[model samples]
Target chain A: MHDDLYLALRQCIIDGDPEQAIELCQRALAAGIAALDAINEGLVPGLNHVGEQFAQGEMFLPDLVMAGEAMKAATAILEPAMQKAGARRETLGKVVLGTVQGDIHEIGKTLVGTMLSASGFEVHDLGVDVPFETFAVKARELNADVVGVSALLTTTMTGQKNVVEALERHGLRPRVKIVVGGAPVTRSWGEEIGADGYGEDALAAVALAKTLLGK
Target chain B: MQPKLEILERELIERILGEAFTLIAEPGVKVQAPAAVELLAGAGARIEEGVAHIPEALARRALASAPREFFLHNRAGEAVVRYGGDAVQFDPGSSCVHILDPATLEHRMTQAADLVRLVQVAEMLPQYAAQSTAVVCNDVPKETGDLYRLFLVLLHSSKPIVTGAFAAHSVPVMIELLAADSGGREALRRKPRAVFDVCPSPPLHWSEFAGQNLADLARAGVPAEVVSVPLAGAAAPVTLAGTLVQHAAECISGIVIHQLAQPGAPVVWGGAPAIFDMRSGITAMGAVETAMLNVACAQVGKHLGLPTHGYLTGSDAKVMDAQAGMESGVAALMGALGGINMISGAGMLDSLACHSAEKLVLDAETIAMAQRVLQGIRPRGESLALAMFAQAGLRGEFLKLAETRKLFRSEQHLPSSVIDRGSLHAWEQSGAKDTFARARERVAELLAAYRRPALAAEVEGELKAIVGEQARRAGMEQLPGLGT
Candidate 1:
């Protein structure tokens, strides 16, 4: 019965049925399934799979956003039991992320922000065309362990170096590991610019942030 | 093959080139590099010493005669790097000297072995055309940046190289080094093993170094790909239309130089430009808009009736993490969809700063899917009728059809382990590994099974000796494990 409920919850999430997830959580609760069990065995696992499929392009971003909402709803329902059991989700690390100025491209930034959030990083996404100072300001405000900046041009890729230089001028360098990414960034580049980390893609970004945060 | 961009159909392409030619003739390119201007003048371009006034008729005539498509012959398969062919081929660029390892989360120095392994894997993938020359081995010297990457990639694979030199001084030497493996330098010139990239500064200009490189590479008969980088909102016109015009102008001018250097010489109109980041002021490689602009400009190249190349396959989504997968996948998908010829920048990570073997494998799987997507559907005569459908029956399942079993595998793409096909329970059984973890294992397996290409003993000796000579010239006591 536990296995069946778990599978059903997973399918519901994969199918992107938020209402069904909430309904199933209620049903599982009535069936005497522990709220913690509902979350651990049902919600988180389902969403993780959802993220995997979405990443693989077996599904798309709509599926991911819906599954995120479903996971949130399930987590909310299981909150009391989770708190009672002292179940704490370990945040990998806090990341202050944003797209650099002049370019308004946001999908990649939004996708990273979403994945990082789901991966348990506290992401402070200072939306599109973020000003350079905002990064230092937000990193300080959030006490962020990593600052991830995104640019998408040969001209704009220089902005990543500028952000690191700005951080250095403000004495924010080394205090917070700054990572830069976009279509044009390279690791040698990260080293050339003295950045703490560089991710070729978004998932690696999250993992790098975790490492920087010492998770 | 994806359908041609409607607005950029053959007639329109001819028309675009016509307009581009007019722009070039009326306002010849401003050659910022005197050496380049001299070369162009010497080669036949109408130049009054420093200024090159490219005639529109010459630009169009040269491109009109140039082939619209070409093929890179590799053992795996003939990858059609089509300006207009079966599909666009994407090769990740060469030589990022550092990588942020996802496993360690720390930035580590990159090595030449990393590049060799990457080229081997990139060779296996259907997406890449000629493994890139940018493999940097940290164990080797770093004076030439990624020349070591190119050397090892040559040693490891026979794939054509989509590479560029970081320093102008090394371009000829590197090309000479590449020739050591095949026939003498002259014979190597015939087959054209590598495509040297030349970029014009956007807003209609060319750097002294880049311009000279273009002229010299053209003189060498090595295929030259003129890269016009117009960063929208930065070095380029902010509007997309403006950017395309600037791109056309640059390519037209470069084409005139290339043709005049040696009329009928091969050249690919290419670029890796993206919009500038207004915030920190950098070129962002991960923006969808950048990738989109890349495709649109490729349309301009097609308009010029020339084969187009764009280094649009890498993304700065940073890590090989989810962000990397999505951003890389999107660019790969669009690039294939747009039918770009010879798309470079594969396997790049950290926005383009790093290259990962694992991500190379994963991107290959993504390319396979994207290639399938670009294939659209093949409606052969056998597939045109309801007769086969009748055999499957009404309200029916394909699982029960004998024909379904026969054709399913061929019709559908069976993705590598990079794609998780396991159900929840099966996935749980497999230790619930993430995509990155699975990709890592797959990378290990592919590398383990890799067989190095065979070279004639003399060729092998020569290739090794070149590296040895280079090492010696650089004052190395001995060359690393490159066998003589």
Candidate 2:
């Protein structure tokens, strides 16, 4: 019976049915299954399968985003229960992401946040046209392990360097890794701005985040 | 007699425009400039927190006043590029940061010398009707880079330029540079030698600088080409029709602002729309869907009887290979058949980040082929080849006939040596060069054959003084040598 419940929970997430996934999580918790077990044995495996299918070309961005939504919904339901039982879920790292000032381009930065969240990194997306002070404030507040800056236009790309300076002003450099990305952000530009890494796209961003954290 | 292509039917275009009008009035467009907001508000648009809900009637009034066509003139005062109807012209893609290195096949930061070389190559090719301020000069300070590029194009080529300004303040300075070349501001306005491209941020938002540029160009009587870039599935709706509605909304709002600033100002409905690649998270400029969007967008523009422009003939490949050829060639033909007035993006690669001089030469050949295709099938004589068949008879010796010799040149497009046609043995005997290799050699020959057009001594001195003064303001003591 427990095995059947777990299978149903995993299938719901794979199907991208957020409401069904949440119901399954609630049912599992009421039936004496551990909250951590529901997340580990059900939600994580479903997200992992979606990732694998995405890599193999069997799925697309909308599919991946839907599955991420399901995972997030199911996890949210189980989080309070896990906290009541003194449980903690393992995460890769905490990342603060945003598009820099003077650029209101949102899609590229949003994609990075979604991919990082789906990959088990705790993401704090500050949204578009973010001020430099907000980035520094969020990094200090969240105790972020990594901060990713995105700028789509060449005119706004210099804002990435200003972001680096903002983080340094708050004395968050050296300990926190900075990864810059967007259509115009290049490896050399990242290095020139004193960023630790640069990602060509969202996938490269996830991989670079892992390497930065030594995962 | 031109072979035309249409992507959107008449009914569909009406429906799209209807939706676009509703969008601007309901969700409204975000206007960052206070003056633009005031202009729209004074014109009866509801202003609620910097967003203008423009009514369809206001947009129609603006459209009615907008000029249907405009001409870009050369230094000799000849109207060379027409931005109306089915007249198609091409220029290299503008403002790329990198130039593809011929020796290493790598992309390097483009400098002033690189921009000069690109202008010279474009000046010699009759296939390119106008020159573009094609590449960014990394050698200059960022503040003055826009004017520096225009200065180089004016010195090297007498062709009318397709260019843009990055900052709002630079618009007037760039215009001043053009005026100095054409004798004065009034003369430059009478025969406009350049068109400035001003783009709106996607999903119905115009940045402050972009809004200022539209007004500045309108008041100055210079042409402003609105390049609306809607990245499908990212900044815009994923479906092609949905994106078209968004494009129309953005462009109509721009026209309203431009015409309000100056009634009867000229504007071109231009775009660089692309599909956002889901797998790679990149804007796929080379995709067939992107071409479809451009063709459909221009059809909507033509529906309103306005001048149109598009970005095509670009490749996503990092190198000059078969993928580059297929992508660039297919889109060039599509843009031509769709009757885009001014097609930009030849010599662009890596999703429009890099420019290649060799690729520029090769694209000229592709442009030549597209122009030939535009001249649809026509009967040369009264018999439509029947008389020629009567002369040849069963002997099949049309090669010996005088009519054949007289008509073949007009009938066929004789491509340059860049396109290989000789036998395999002959190709192998002459170093077995591929298209890229042949293109590199062609670049050298064209550069060697290039002679700079002479300008009036007084006008030339004035041009230098304007550029030099701007350079000093940006902390540069001297302008980079043009190697003239």
Candidate 3:
């Protein structure tokens, strides 16, 4: 019976049905299966499958985003149960993300956040037009392991450097890894801005975050 | 009279526009510029998380104010290139990074001298009505590259230019360069000697830089050409018609932002769309489907009574071979027949990554043929060919007749030595050169014949000072290819 429940949970994520995923989580709880097992044996494996398909070009951006949505919804349902049982999901790191100030481009930054969260990172997306101080404050409050700044315009990409300086001014530079990305951000630009790393795209961002945390 | 080609049916175009307007109001366009968002919100567009759901009524209002025609003027203030109503013109492709070396048969990074040579060659060719910043100069700093190109074009060529900016900040400076050449900002606006090409990101999005450019160009009364690029099956829908709907939506939203900033600004419904080759993962600019997409997209623009432009006459071949000729020739004919007002991409190859001056000369012959085709068949006299036949009287001497002499010059298109029409004996005497060899010779002859156009000393001094300041700001001591 537990095996069937785990299989159904995996199917919920692959099919990207958030409501169905929530229903299955409740069923797992009612059937007395551990919430941690449901996630480790079911949800993570399903997301891994989606990631593999995405890398192979079998899946696209919308599919990956939907799968991420299903995972987020399913996790919310089991969080209370997992805490009651003194269980925890393994996280790679905590990441604070946003499109830098004076720029409103959101698609790329949102994609990077979703991918990081789905890959087991604790993501706090600050949203678009975020001030540099907000990034510093968030990193200090959340004790984030990584901070990713995005800018889609050549004119506004200078904000990435401002972000790096803000982190240094707050003395959060040593603890937090800085990763800059966008359509205009390049590897050399990241180096020039004193960023720890650069993500050419969302997938690369996730991988770079993992490497930074030594996972 | 000119022959015309239409790919989309009247009903299909209406359906595409209808679907496009619905898309604009539903998913809306993701505008990254805050000022643009404010303008749309003030115009009654529903804003949701930076996406503006523009109403159909607003788009129509913008379209109504856009001018249906505009002119790009030469340095002498002659209206040489028209952008409306089946007036076909051609210019070399813009912003290539490599120039193909005829000796090495390999691509090398371009420098300021390469661009100067291209401008000089293009100036002598009557086939290219306007000039383009044909190649990027690798010697210059990246931040100042866009302005540096325009400065070089103004200094080297007398023709009006088609150029674009890499960033929003660069746009104003480039415009200032043009204004300095035209006496003042208002004079430049009145007889605009240049048109800036602004592109929007595909799948219903416009980056902040592009949005800002649209607004600035509109307020300044400079012409803006909206180059909407949608790669099929990758960034957009796989089907051609579906891509057209996306293209129309992007362009319609761009026009809305442009016209809202300033009413009655000149904008061209232009695009450089191509099919994504699934096998190679490249945008095949030379494919027939790409040409169809360009022609059909222009058809939609014409249906709305707007000026049209398309990127054609480019090839994906690596060299000046048969593939280059076939791809470039066919597309040039199709674009001309389809009535694209300003057809670009003449010397471009390798999917628009490289430019070759020899290929530019060769493509001029191809363009000459296409222009001849556009003339179609016309009756010159009352009896057609009967008068010439009567004068010859079955003696097989029509070539010697006065009527033949008088009419053949107008009737026949006399291509240059780039195209061979001599007998084998004559060809051997001329060294039996292939088309590329002949094109190389032609390029050399044209460059030799190029003469710089005269400019007032004060205007020249103003241009030098402006460009010199920019060069210093970019940390360069002196400009490349310009002697003190």
Candidate 4:
């Protein structure tokens, strides 16, 4: 019976069903379920399954968007109770995610965010077209474990290094774990920009973040 | 559709083919790598002093046995396309990232969910033919990218898939996937729709993995595509002619290997060759040199009577702006005119590294326009305006004539939104939007309109069980969401 609920929740997310997902999540929360219990038991497994199916080509974008919203909704509900219980989720680490300045491509960032969240980390998505200042300010404000910046184009790849350079200028370089992603980013590039790590794809990014946090 | 090129104009095509031939005949292409050289030497191709020149006669003999057209079946077990005529085939190319938020430049691992969305989008659009570019996992540890993409495409759509099996070791698993699933072995073997792409690394080489894949694909009765990726200034000589010679040598050598493995099995004359930008040291997909290499080489491939393939239709333009449209549009146009039978790399951006969801929608629009262009002009009977104009009398406006409405839709390739046409009042009423915003809205609408497809209860169970086994083996004790 619970497996059905679990499958439904995942399907709802992959379908991008925020409203229905909210209702389902609310029900689970009302049932006095452990917040971590719900996440570990229901949400994480669900998204991961969707992701696997997605990788297998069984699911796609609507499913991804649906899954993201469902994840967001479930996480929103899970966070309050976990905080009350003094049971902060044992995350792989914290990641500050953002798209670089003058560019609004966020699919890479969102995928990284979803993967990070599923991997058990707190991700502060700074939305799109974020300047280097926004990332530095937020990393400080949120106390990010890693600041991951993504840029899709060759022209905007410079924006990736700009964030790292900004952290340096602000004298916050040592404190932050800087990572770069998107299509144009390579390990060589990450080295060139003095970023701590670089991920060619989402799966690699998770491993990179985990390693940086010493998790 | 445009009238067929006249027999008189066929001479021009012959000239183009002859030009490609002259280069290959003279100053024979340099063959690098022992695997390719040995393979060519084994298959009756002439090789001397490390220079491999596949005689035109041999190319013809190989193509004589090559199948001109084939069909790929969809999920419902229906053949969805007849791969001939002016039909343009699109498939998911090898990509590392699927642009989820193009505006934010955010990407996620192209997971199963992304594959599902891509399949839906590809199905709805007129451009795509095959079901893949599906990467198997976003988080799984073991699966490599090429194999992963293949697995995902297999699961998501019933459409015949277009995939390149990477790293020779994965071939067994891939063959199992194509053969082992719900369908029995004969059903799997008989269908033979997954046309595997085998690349000969430039200046002329096939790694053991690719050589092995060619043998495996052919022995299994599946068709083969001889793919070459010669980056000018890096892989081949910087000249277009030099690249074409290298591309020909690569194909001829590949054909020899493929046919040697299993005689008369199909093979494509395929390449994704491009130029390395001198400024950034990056491979430039948008450069005119890149377009010329693809087009000119395609002519050579056709000259050998082989079904040609090129990984064109991809753009590196960062944003979904004018640059994206112009770059993708011109490249797609050239690819179409060059008589490329299968053009992969749709929905790709940033020089085939990143793929954009929004751009996929926009690129579909551009492909629609290119398809219309290839249609050319029709000089059909009454279709010519002579009779209509005679009836309408002098000074009659064609716009006001009754035949205008009757023939306009047929004559004029009407675009479904993404190309807006509205009077000022109607335009203002409908939200005065440019192409990108309108594209944004279209993407949202398509996404919103999507209904999650229900897999068979049994298939869903199998998929879940497979994932569960992996997670549990990875040492997660309590299954996620199981008790909830």
Candidate 5:
């Protein structure tokens, strides 16, 4: 019976229904199921499935975002219960994402943020026209595991390199990884700028974050 | 020769108009300009906060006052480009920040030299009736960029320019520069040397800057090409027809203000409408649906007997590849066949983010091909080559005859040396260059052959002085040095 409930919870996450996923979590707990089992067996597996499909090109950003929302809602409900039972919820990693300074392109960075969150990483989207200092400050504040910088113009692509230097200047580079992607950005550019990884698109970005975490 | 591609039925068009007016009356258009709000409110429009609920009749009346056709005259004071009556003219796309460097095949920020080279190429091409302030020169201050681009084009070519003013204050300054070229304000108004493209923000919003520019263009007697950009599935409805209604309403709102500011001024039924690619979330200007929207909207504009324009002959490809050729060629043909008056946005790549002079040369060929297609079959006096048939009678000796010599030039579009029509042996001997390489060579040849049109020394001095004054106003000591 609990297995069937866990399956329902997984479907709710896949369907991207945060409300339904939270209600399912409540029903599972009311049925005397362990909160850890609900998260590890249901929500985590569900998000992992979404991430795999995204990496395999079977799912897109919108679907991944919905599933991420569902997982977040389910986790919000389960974390308190897990704490009461002397356990804590696990995460893949934390990510800080934004379009670099002087570039206001929103779509690419937001897509990567959504995919990272869906892949079980806690993503903080700093939004467009973000200053270089802010990326470093946010990474330090959130204790972020990865910083993903995006730039759509060649004129502003240098800002991405400056972001890497900023993180290094703040002494956060040793602990946190850096990933860069945009229309004009390439893998060689990422390497030349001392970034840990580079992605051509959102799926590759999610995979890069996962690899950085050794997941 | 006029060719049209019609999509909406008569009843469907009527229904669309009804729906459009209903949309305007309910949610109305958001007019951010206080003067525009007052202007509409005084003209029987019901104003609720920022939105102006225009009556259907008021919009139709504005449409009536707009000229059915207007001409953009060259420096020679001749009507070279018609903005009505199934005329088709193309100009290179505008305001791209980067140029695809032909030497290195890399995209870089456009400089003063790049813009001058672009203007020279466009000036040499007979296919381009007018020139545009195509690439934004990064060397110039952003405040004075628009007028400086206009200055560069006017100095390099005698052609009429399709330019825009970024800030409302710059509109009059650009107009003054054009007046200096045209001799005076009266001469400029009588035969305007340039048309300013004034745009409105999409999804039923016109900001105060655009509003002021429209009114200024109207009162100054300079033509205002109202470019309404609607991004479907984001700012507009997902369906094409639904998007068309919103486009019509937005254009209608612009017309009302433009005509109210000065009745019987020249205003184009122009827009750059494209589908929002849901996956990429970028405005897909190269999408077939984007071309379809242009054709359909122009058709509606023609139905209303208004001058029409569309953004076409552009591609989303990052380079001048097969995708660029396919997208640019197909859209150019569609706009021509649909009888759009002025089709802008050629020679653009990476979704209009970059410009290429080589692509401009290639697109000139594409436009020439589309123009050939629109010419249709010219029946030769009902003879159907009977005179030639009587002499040859399938003997296949026509190539040796006088009629063949007389007819071949008229019948065939013998492309320039830019297009490779040679045999394999000849091709191999020419270093086996690709289309892009050939285009680069052609670009070099065109620039080498370009002769700057002579202008009056005083007028040239006046234009330079105006640029210098504008630059100083923007906190620059002088204008950027003009490059060769």
Candidate 6:
């Protein structure tokens, strides 16, 4: 019965049915299944499958977005139960992401955020045109393992460098790795700016984040 | 000429229109402007909670009142662009915040110099029928960015402009500036030099600013192009057909309000519709499905016998690579074959986030090729070159024939120097440049050849004064120099 529940939850997420995903979580909990077991065996695998499909180009943005919604619904129900039982939900890492200051481009950063979350990282999206200090402050507050900076223009690449400087100044550079990506951002620029890593696109971002965490 | 393409059947178009008419009355459209609501309410529309229920007869009547075609005149007082029929004109994409610098091949915040260069390039290129206020100069204050771009375009080029007003209040000043350029308000009306693009928020919502612009542009006798964007899957519906229904409904509502403002002010059925790529959560402008949406929606507009416009010749690729070429090439061809009157989105890249002058010139080549295809087998004199073929006698070399020399220029589209049709040895001698490198060279050459179209000194001073006055009102004391 637990195995069937897991399959149902995974299928619900793949189908992008958030309400069904939450109800299945509740039903699994009512049936005396452990919350962490439900998350690891069901929600995580569901997100992983969705991510794989997205990478393989079998699924598009709306499907992935729906899957994200479903995963959130399942997590919302299971997370509280896990806390009550004194168990913690496993995360790959925590990341704070934003488009750098003076660059109002949001799609690239938003894509990276969604892909990271689907790959098991907890993400705090600070949104577009985020100032440098905000990145460090948010990273320190969240105790994030990674902070991804995005700049779509060459002019705004300075904002990414400023973010790295702020992270070092806050004494959080050692704990939090910095990853940068945008249209104009290159691997050489990443090295020049003292970034921990670089992503050519959103899929590469997920891989870079994993390598940064040594996962 | 190439054969025209149609994505929607006549019956299906009728059904879509019928559904849109019903949609306007049923759930209805939300109008945020009290003045627009009053206009619709006065025009026999039922209003409740800011939503106006327009009747089918009222919509039909409005459509009938709007002129089927109108012309935008150039500075020389020549009607250079017609907004109806099978006229296919290209314009560089508008309002991009960043420019893809050809020299460094990097994106940067657009400057006033960038806008000026863009206009100069478009002014020189025969491919673009009109020049657009292509980019927002970030060097200037944001409040006056839109009108400021237009000001620079007017200052730099003699071509009629495709532009928009960013603020509702800036509309009258912009009109005044155009009038000053054209000698006066009455003369500007008689030969309007610019068409303002007005937009409505998708899913049947028109903002107060949008309504005000539409009403003001209508009352001023300036042409207004309604750009209604509906993102299929995310904003409208997952299906393209459902999105088309929403597109028609939005456009119909826009026209209802526009015609209500004035009985017969010109408004084009224009939109930028794209499929919501579910995986990336992007409105994929480069996708074939997105191009189909534009074609199909324009078909609905054409069936209603209105002037139509669409966003095409755009790409989602971040770089000027193969993906950009393929996506933009296909979109441009489809839009051309689709017969959209005023096709925008040329020179646009990264899903319209960035503009490149190199890409603009290259896309013009693509448009030239599309125009050749549109010419579709002109046999001339009711015969298939019978006399020339008879003289050549099948498979005979026509290269030396006098007929070939005389007719070749007309029959074939001989591309400009930008396109490389040379021997490999010649290419190697010419710096071993790829198309991008060659395009960069061409851009420099064009800029070297560019001369700012002459304007009366008094008129030029007046245009500058108006822009400066508006910048001051917006809390910016000085207008940023165009850096010409």
Clashes (N, CA, C under 3 Å) per candidate: 62, 0, 0, 52, 0, 16
- What is the CA-based DockQ of model 2? 0.58
lDDT (10s digit) by residue, model 6, range B108-153: 7788888888888888889899999898787777678778888999
- lDDT of each residue in B382-447, candidate 4, tens digit only: 557788788677988777877777778777777767778878898788888878778777777776
Docking class of 1: incorrect
Among the candidates, what TM-score does chain A have in each? 0.76, 0.96, 0.98, 0.85, 0.87, 0.93
Report the poorest 10 consecutive residues by lDDT, candidate 1 chain B: B73-82
Quality of model 2 by C-alpha lDDT: 0.91
TM-scores, each model vs. reference: 0.66, 0.97, 0.75, 0.62, 0.85, 0.83
DockQ by candidate, in order: 0.04, 0.58, 0.08, 0.05, 0.19, 0.27
Tens digits of per-residue lDDT, candidate 5, A76-127, equal 8887888999986567888999999867666678778877776667789999
User: Which residue runs of candidate 6 sit more than 4 Å off their true CA positions?
Assistant: A1-4, A19-23, A52-58, A75-215, B389-397, B475-478, B481-484
Q: Distance from true position, residue B434, model 1, in Å?
A: 1.4
lDDT of 5 by residue, B176-259 (tens): 999999889998888887888887777788888788888889888899888887878766787999988988888888989999
Candidate 1 similarity to native, TM-score: 0.66
What tens digits encode model 3's per-residue C-alpha lDDT throughout B1-484?
Answer: 7898899999999999999999999999999888788889999999999899999999999999999999999999999999999988899998887789988987877888888988888898888999998888878887788899999999988898999988888988998999999889999989999888898988898888899999999988889999998888777898999999999999999999999999999999999988866543456879999999999999999998899889998899989999999999989999999999888899998876789999999988899898999988899998987887878878878779877788887799999999999999999998999999999999999988878788788988898898888889999887886631
What's the C-alpha lDDT at position B384 in model 1? 60
Best by lDDT: 2
Q: Which segments of model 4 are wrong by more than 4 Å?
A: A1-215, B1-64, B82-86, B98-100, B106-112, B134-137, B142-144, B180-182, B380-383, B394-402, B424-431, B451-484
DockQ ranking, best first: 2, 6, 5, 3, 4, 1
- Worst lDDT run of 10 residues, candidate 1 chain A, spans A152-161
Candidate 1 per-residue lDDT, tens place, B1-484, comes to 4554433456645554565666665566778677767765664667654557776665666676555655443323344344354357778765575565757856566665556667777766666766776555657654444455567767777777777765466677777766675466675555667777777766556666667777677767677888887777666666666666677888777776666667666788788878765432346667788787788778777655677887666767556778888877888777777778777777777545677877788888878787788767776446664756787667666688677777677679998888998799999999999988998898788777777777677876776676676777666675553531
| Greater-TM-score candidate between 2 and 4 | 2
Q: Against the true chain A, what TM-score does chain A of candidate 2 give?
A: 0.96
Distance from true location, Cα of B340 in model 5, Å: 1.2
Question: Cα RMSD for candidate 3?
Answer: 5.8
Q: What is candidate 4's CA lDDT for residue B251?
A: 74
Candidate 4, backbone clash total: 52
